[model samples]
Target chain A: MHGYTANKDDILKRLRRIEGQVRGLQRLVDEDTYCIDVLTQVSATTKALQSFGLTMLEDHLYSCVADAIAEGGDGARDKVQEASQAIARMVRT
Target chain B: MHGYTANKDDILKRLRRIEGQVRGLQRLVDEDTYCIDVLTQVSATTKALQSFGLTMLEDHLYSCVADAIAEGGDGARDKVQEASQAIARMVRT
Candidate 1:
């Protein structure tokens, strides 16, 4: 079972809301919204998205990576290695 | 200069502080601190770390990956492809 299983719907819903927030911010630009206000909202939206992203990453590592580590086969080894690179990308970024 | 150039140190410092915050949270647990308070602080720290990670990712896409894409070579193609996987990991997380 995936760790993301429990809150998958909730996370997707939140991301959709954020996507709408971003589109609204873009429209604000088209309509010349106040720079500070738009920027403020952008910052908030960015933080929200990042929070969401982190939750998914944490779950992936805890569940998928740990499972791969425990399984110990050719496929499992590949999976674990790929997960490492994924993690390096996440934190290196 | 790198994409992480301008704020590299600052970001690292923030991460270090967050690490400290995490340790503090552990201590809170050890000391039997209020569950809600510890959880709240943990959430904040996680969000902060994620936000920082996003900044670095954005910069990498804008500068490093873009540069690799703009150039032409086996190395450049490999770099861009690797970056794609990295971004996929970030969002697919």
Candidate 2:
């Protein structure tokens, strides 16, 4: 199983809260809120997603990647590669 | 500036490493690595992205969201909504 299984509930809860926040944003846009105000909200949302992604990465490194490294051989290499790709994508965003 | 600006360089550096990892994955696939092995790499990549997202979220909450809330009124509400949407999108992924 994936390492995230350990904290899946907590993660999901956080996601749900974030979903609500998005809905609120839509409302603000609908109401014709100020441009800077909307942009600020957008900035907040982007940060939140990035933060969530980082937390997950830490868990993966500590749990999944660590396990792979302990196992050694191709497993270790693959895990490292996987992690690197994940990081690259995050940065691009 | 976004809260992540402080750590943008670090984040980008990490991302560059991840990008290399992804390239490795493509190579693995090209070499016909085992199916389970590839799957494992995929899983790792996903987790890493999620983790990255979470990190950004934390920064947003601490900096941008906090600032908006401190300012009060519509700003606070808008920030909250934006955060919620970001979380929701992350979870959906």
Candidate 3:
């Protein structure tokens, strides 16, 4: 099982909410809503996704990375590297 | 009409694509995909959403905000302030 497996339901719930937000954005656009209003919604949606990513990242560190570190092998270093790369990608986004 | 009026189709298309990406994330989690893989997809989705937000913001600046500025009144100042606040929100996200 993956690090997020335990929180799968929570992760899916967040994604579903984000999906709904995106759909709302489309509705606003279809109705010719003001640009600033739409942009505000976009920011809210992005924040939600960012929050979700942080939760997942924290879980990965606590579960997967911790396991690797406890095992005392090169896998610990590799996992840390992989997590850092994921973080970099997140930051760039 | 709003700043995004002309690009309504494009904006809606981007939102639809984002919605699809969010759904894909749900699928990945439900299927027990690896944590890093899911996180990677999350980053991609965030980037797409940010790109969409930037396009909408640019349109607002070129159209609504610009129109207000061209008119040269208190409204122009208000519009600029509003847009700046939106940008701040986006940056925070």
Best candidate (score: TM-score): 3
Residue-by-residue lDDT tens digits, candidate 2, B6-91: 76666556445444444554554455454335445544544554565677678778888899999999999988888887777666
| Candidate 1 error regions (>4 Å) | A1-93, B73-77
**Candidate 2 accuracy as lDDT:** 0.62
lDDT of 3 by residue, A1-93 (tens): 878888778888888989999999999999998999998999999999999999999999999999999997899999999999999999998
What does the interface RMSD come to for each candidate? 13.2, 12.1, 0.8
Q: Choose the strongest candidate by lDDT.
A: 3
Q: Could you tell me the lDDT of residue B53 within candidate 2?
A: 60
- Highest-DockQ candidate: 3
How do all models score by TM-score? 0.45, 0.51, 0.98
After best superposition, candidate 3 residue B68: deviation in angstroms?
Answer: 0.4
DockQ of each: 0.03, 0.04, 0.91
DockQ-derived CAPRI band for the predicted complex in model 2: incorrect
Q: What tens-digit string does per-residue lDDT give for candidate 3 at B50-93?
A: 99999999999999999999999899999999999999999988
Q: List model 1 lDDT by residue over B7-88, tens digit each.
A: 8889889889989989989899999998999999888887777667666765664456445544535645565456545655
Best-first order by TM-score: 3, 2, 1
Candidate 3 chain A lDDT trough over 10 residues, lowest sum: A2-11
Candidate 3 global TM-score: 0.98
Instruction: In angstroms, give how far residue B69 of model 1 lies from its true place.
Output: 1.6
After superposing candidate 3, which stretches have Cα over 4 Å from the reference?
none
- Cα RMSD for candidate 1? 16.8
